[model samples]
Target: MTGVTQQAKSSKDRILEAAVAMTGENLGAGLSVRAVAARAGVSTGSLRHHFPTQRALQEAVLTAIYDLVIPDDHVIHDTSLPARDRLIACLRLVLAPAAPGKPSREAWSTVYERFIAPEPTEELRATYLATAREGLRRVEYWLSVLVEEGALAAGDNTRRARFLNTVVGGLSVERAMPGEASVLEAETEVLGMAVDAVLASREPGE
Candidate 1:
């Protein structure tokens, strides 16, 4: 039984690795059951036995990507740093890939062509949503950590995480276009404002 369990775990790992490799070429859209099975060198039945559905496969791949992209060693773990700084560093990781100038524009173009200009298929939608949810989860984890550390005021972290993500998303979109001089300064100011808003003391309500 242990041997069978180990074998199943290995198979699942191989499938996830193959799917992650394919994401490098076409984001997460390369995770089709047939395509991933071929890439992983597994039979369709075997793939189905592990993933059951394409959505499941996509979610697993996205989670794997999240683990690779944001490991436990990330800045968020550095309690030596100020909690606000650590949170900002964590948020910046999301923006790092979309560099300024041509690269950022090209990345946005790919996003548009693949998921925006055309009506996305169910699989595409699922993949995109899975990616977004993973991102949100990461941000929420950051907020939760700060709260636990007594660095951040405890309130509705879900709302705070959502607000922070929206700010990051808007900044990502802005990167795709031309910006004034001192773009870095502008971004930093905006990020600081966002961090302050979430950290501010809660007021009395009706």
Candidate 2:
């Protein structure tokens, strides 16, 4: 039983890895079961045993995207660092480049591309949207840390978090678009300004 379980897990991991790799190449280019199975070097039957269907593969791929993009440590837990600094680090880590062909920029590429692709069923669209909402919540938990430590200025933390995420989302779209002329300097400057703007004011300026 243990051996079988381990093999099943290994096969599942391969499928997820293959999907993630495909996502990197063209963002939502080729993610169908047949394509994924070929990339994973597994039979369609074996792939179905793990993923069951297309939506399952997409959800798993979304999970994989977040896992790669989100920071790997609990730096927010350290009492030594100021909440503001920790919060900034958290956001930066999510957007910062991890390595060549890794998750940082790739996450946005996948999102925009996925949105453009047509889904065959409403169920898949709903599942995709749910996964996206899950992606946005990644930083909300760390923002709460800022609130608890009293480092964050008094205001609606949820709105502030969403606002920052929206900024990041827009930036991601810009970066993902073709022929956008990669401008790391300008991009980083804008992101820094956005973070600073959030921390500098509690007015929730309309």
Candidate 3:
């Protein structure tokens, strides 16, 4: 690659890395252009050149996060594993950032403070929606892979993905709250049930 192109790519990478770090720290609330530029050690003009709008920057950062956060393609693609087991493993990956007890509670508290407790600004609302959309998209992608393997019946997986996401979301909340001592076992059972529903689902005509 030419020197100038290489330099531009490096600058963009730095900006994206900074934004992802800030999002992890503050849950997308402090992702202002100035703050991201400062964290990236790039001038505001440079940041803007790479990402023209705050929404654009936020979306790009979120895409990068999906890449970083969900690298479980191995689990999804391992055909030897039971289809239900693979799906459950993929869903479990979503809960890694918020394990049970104090850490999980703290993660939920952050969500409450940023998006729920306050009347969110337009930008915050957009960010949260983008996050939810990306999550559903990710689950859909996992289901598609299983369908390709003939492990899951082929159909439009939008509804299936939503159901699985709801189950995972509820599990996350359960982890944050006081729960029975058999939390892990119960979690596994719930996930299996969710996976079974998706796997057994048939299209309306069928």
Question: lDDT values of the candidates?
Answer: 0.81, 0.68, 0.88
Predicted structure with the largest lDDT when compared to the true one: 3
lDDT of 3 at 44: 98
* Candidate ranking (TM-score, best to worst): 3, 1, 2
Alpha-carbon runs more than 4 Å astray in model 3:
1-9, 28-30, 43-45
The per-residue C-alpha lDDT of model 2 at residue 195 equals: 69
Q: Give the TM-score of candidate 3.
A: 0.88
Worst 10 residues of 1 by lDDT: 1-10
TM-score-best of 1 and 2: 1
- Candidate 2 lDDT by residue in tens digits, 1-206: 34544246577888888888886675535377888888888898989999897777877787677777775357778778766566666766665653223344576555555665566356556655756665666666766666677766667766777888887766655655453445455567776787677767675463
User: Which one wins by lDDT: 1 or 2?
Assistant: 1
As for model 1, its CA RMSD to the true structure in angstroms is 4.3
Clashing pairs in 3: none
lDDT of 1 by residue, 29-97 (tens): 647778887888788898999899877877788778877776644588899899888988888888887
Residue 69 CA displacement from its true place in model 2, Å: 3.5
**TM-score for each model:** 0.86, 0.57, 0.88
After TM-score superposition, the amount by which residue 185's alpha carbon in candidate 3 deviates from its true location, in angstroms, is 0.6
How good is model 1 by TM-score?
0.86
- The prediction achieving the highest TM-score against the true structure is 3
